[model samples]
Target: MARVNELKRQLKPGQVYRREDLTPYSNAVDRHLAQLVRDGTLQKLAQGLYYFPKKTAFGTPPPNDETLVRSFLKDKRFLLTSPNSYNTLGVGTTQLYNKRVVYNLKRHEEVTLNGKTFFFHKTPYFPKKATPEFLLVDLVNNLDSLAEEREQILKNILAKAKTMNLAKLEHAVDEYGHSKTKKLFRPVLAEMKKTRHAQ
Candidate 1:
C-alpha cells in the first residue's frame, strides 16, 4: 500500500479517482481502496468515484452537489441546473426564501450530495454545452413558462444583475441560447449591462 498512499497524497480534495486509475500505482487495487476507506482517508461519493475525505478551505467535504456535478460531466456541454426550474416556479427574489434545487436541462432524475438533494429539469440543449449564465436564463425561462410570478422573478434577476455580474449574465442568454432567450431575458440582461437597471 505504499503506492496507494502515494496516489492518495498526489490527489486533491475535490478530485475524483476510479479503480482503473490506480492500476498503474498498484496491482492489488481493490484491497488498497478498501483499506483507505477503512482508515477514513477516502470516501466513496458513488459506485465508481472516490475522493479524499478532507474539506477544502471553502468549508466543505469533497464537494456539494454542484461541484460533484462538474466532476461527473465529461465537459461543458451539460451543466447541473435547478435554478432554471426554481426560477420557473416563480419563487422570485423573495427574502427569507433560500430554497435551492438540483438538476439540469437534460437530466431527468435528481442526485443528492452531502445530505442535500437537488432536482434537474429539461432544456432544449439537453446533452449539449450549457454555460452557467445560459443555465440561468433557461432556468428563468422555466420560471417564466410555469409560475404565475414569472415577471417578478425576471425583474428580481435583472435587478440583481450587477451583483451577479452583467457581462456574464448576458453571456448566458447570448452565447448558448437564442434570440428568444434574449427577448425573455432582456430586462435582466440589459439592466445588468448598465449602471442602474430599471424599466
Candidate 2:
C-alpha cells in the first residue's frame, strides 16, 4: 500500500502513461495499476495505456488526441488531422467526418482508443504540424476516401490553390503529394506560373 501510494504520487493529471512507464516506480506495477484503476486514480485507455484525467468545471475532459497518440506510439513524430480540416480551406468540403487520421512512421491500422476512432497511417514523411498547404495536398491524396464529390472538390482546390502561397503549395506537393496528386498539381502549377509571368 505504501509503495502503491508512492507510485500514485508520481502520476501527473491530464497525462497519459504506458504500463512500462509506471513499472520503474512500483515493484508490483500491474497490481498497483489495477488498484489505481479501481479507485479512479487512472482510466484505462487500452491494454497498456492509461490516462490521469484533469478535472474541469464542466467535467473531466478526455485526453488530448496528440497526447493519447504519443503515449500509444511511444513516439512524438506524427501528424493528427481529419477530413473536416479541409473545410477550412474554403474548397467546399463541408461534410463532417467521424474519423481522425494519424500519419506516422510506426503503425498502419484502425484503432479505437478510449471510444475515439483513429486511423493510423504509416507514411515515409509528414510535417510536425498540419499547415494549410499540407492540408490542401493531403485533401487530394485522400480524395477517393472522402465523401465529397471528387471532381468538384478538385476544381475548387485548384481555384483555392491559386489564392495561396505558390511556393509553399508547390513544396507541399513535392514533399507530401502522392503520385496521382503530383500528376494533378503539375499542370495547374505550370499554368499559374504562366499566368503570373504573362501579367
Candidate 3:
C-alpha cells in the first residue's frame, strides 16, 4: 500500500501514464495498477495506458487529446488535427466531423480511448502543430474523405489564397502536400502570380 500511495503521488490528474512509468515504484506494479483502477485512483484507458481522473462539477474529466495521444504513441512526434478544422479555412466546408485525425510515424489504426475516437495514420512526416498553411495543404490532401462539396471548396480556397500567407502556403505544399494537392495548387499559385504581375 505504501508503494501504491507513492505511485499515486507521482500521478497528476488528467495526465496519462504507461505501465512502465510505474515500474520504478514496485516490482508488482501491474497488481498495484489494477488495484488503483479498482479503487478509483486511476482509470485504464487501454491495455498499457491509464489516466488519473480529474474530478469536476460534471464528473471526472477525460484526459486531453495530447495527453492521451502522447501516452498512446509513447512519443511526442505526432500531429493531431481534425477534419473539422477544414471548416475554418473559409473553404465552404460546413459539415462538422466527429472524429480526430492523427498523423504519426507509427500506429496506423483507429483507436478508442476514454470514449473518444482517434484515427491514426502512419505518415513519413507531419508538422508538430497545425498551422493555417499546413491545414490548408492537409485539407486539399484529404478532400475526398471530407463531406463538403470538393470542387466548391477548391474554388473558395483558391479565391481566398490571394489574401493568405503565400510564402507559407507554398512552403507547406512543397513539404506536406501530396502529389494530387500539388497538382491542384500549381495552377492556383500561377494565377496568383499573374494577378500580382498585372497589378
Candidate 4:
C-alpha cells in the first residue's frame, strides 16, 4: 500500500520505532507493521517496539543499548551503565557481568528487549556519563551485589582512589554517593590529605 511505502521510506536502518511513530502514515498502522514484520522488512523487539536492522556482511547488526532503552523509556532522562564497567576502574573487579543497568527516575524493574536484559533502577540522581569518580561511588554503593570479595574490593577501590582527582572524587562522593559510600571514603580522603601535606 502507499502508506506502507511511505512509512518504510521514512525508516532508517538501525533505528527503533514505536507504533505511534508510524501512526501518521495509516490509521491501521498495527496491521501494516504486522505485515512488514512478516515480510522481513522490520523486526519486532517487543510489544509495540520495532527495529529496522542494519545489514552487514555477517548479518543484521544488533540494536544499540542506548537506542533500545531510549525508545523503551520514550525519554532521554536515563543513565546506561553495567557492572562490568567496574572492571575499568582497576579496582580489582575483573569479573564480567552480562547484565546492563539503567539508572533513571522511572522504571524500577528488569526489562528484556530482543533477548537482552536491562535492569532499571529508580534513582533520584545520577551523572550523565559514567566518570571514574561516579563509578567508584556507584561500585561502593552496590558493592554488596557485586560478585567479588567485599573486603578486597574495598581495599582495591581505596587504593585506586588515591590515584584519582581528589577534588572531583570528593565532590562526586558528596553529590551522587550514599551514606555508606561516604563513610567508606572518609578515611581514604583523610589519607589523601595526609599525603598532600607531607608533599
* Top candidate by TM-score: 2
Clashing pairs in 3: none
Q: Residue by residue across 69-176, what tens digits does model 2's lDDT show?
A: 999999998999988999989998999999999999999999999999999999977998899999999999999988898899999999888888888889999999
Candidate 2 residue pairs that clash? none
* Order of candidate numbers by TM-score, starting with the best: 2, 4, 3, 1
The 10 consecutive residues of candidate 3 with the worst lDDT sum are 157-166
Candidate lDDT (C-alpha), each = 0.57, 0.93, 0.87, 0.91
Query: Can you write out model 4's per-residue Cα lDDT over 1-199, one digit (the tens) per residue?
Result: 9888988998999999988888998768989999999999999999899999999999998899999999998889999999999999987888889999999988999999989999999887888999999999999999999889999889898889999998989988998989989998999988998998999
Supply the TM-score for candidate 1. Answer: 0.52
Q: Which sequence of candidate numbers ranks them by lDDT, best first? A: 2, 4, 3, 1
In candidate 3, clashing pairs total: 0
Question: Which consecutive 10 residues in model 1 have the weakest lDDT in total?
Answer: 89-98
TM-score for each of the candidates? 0.52, 0.96, 0.92, 0.93
Candidate with better TM-score, 1 vs 3: 3
Residue 61 error, candidate 1, Å? 3.8
Flag clash pairs in model 4.
none
For every model shown, the clashing-pair count is 15, 0, 0, 0
